[model samples]
Target: MRAAVVISPLASAVLAGCVVSQTQGGAEHLAAPDGAVYEGVDTRLLDGELVNFVVAMRGARGPDDVTAYAECAAAQYALIRGYGFARQVRTTVDEKNGAWTGDAVYTISPALPRGTRTIDAEVVVAACRENGIPTV
Candidate 1:
């Protein structure tokens, strides 16, 4: 009976390990593909009246297939603008180590004239679909 108990615990531990390993492996595999990750958002005011917005994102892709990364960056910017928070957007994308990092900036004005407010936006990043399905 003691041997049976020991075996059961050992089996459970092995199963747990397998599960963990698979989960981590899956994440790594997913991250390996050319894609992007939304880091965070920052907002500020320019000239005390013009609202400024900045979104931070990271993307990765190979040399030949940069279109995916570009699309990803555009999607990120559009997603934020869709929220109706900013008036206009100025975006910048940087690529490094087979990865692309992007920053999107915009502006928001308050109701009162001469009043500027900066809003830091946060967005979730997900993998693009094969059929061009919206991931946001």
Candidate 2:
């Protein structure tokens, strides 16, 4: 009976972890993909095909985590807006108040933007999935 009880709690813990979603944490100011908390933003509306979304996350996150999360959001946003690609304009990652934040500008277009850091819709989506990163 004791063994059975121990096994029951262990199974519950494992199941609990499995149930956590990709976009579960949003305790920050602006939410991002994965458990990255949204810190804040400075997004703007430029033209119909060009948009910039500056986002942040609250945590002891690294530059890679913040950038990847921002890219994931940008890529997903493009897809949601009926665009197939996003051209990365600039990315600024900083640490503030012990929180890691990233500011990125992406140009949404029906086709890939003319940039080396441009993100392809299908490619980014697949990368996010494979890496367990969440998308907007």
| Every model's TM-score | 0.31, 0.63
Cα lDDT, all candidates: 0.32, 0.58
Expressed as tens digits, the lDDT of each residue in 6-38 for candidate 1 is: 111112223344311122111112222435555
What's the lDDT for residue 49 in model 2? 73
Cα error of candidate 2 at position 87, Å: 0.9
RMSD of each: 18.3, 13.9
Model 2 lDDT on a 0 to 1 scale:
0.58
Number of clashes in every candidate structure? 1, 2
In TM-score terms, candidate 2 sits at 0.63
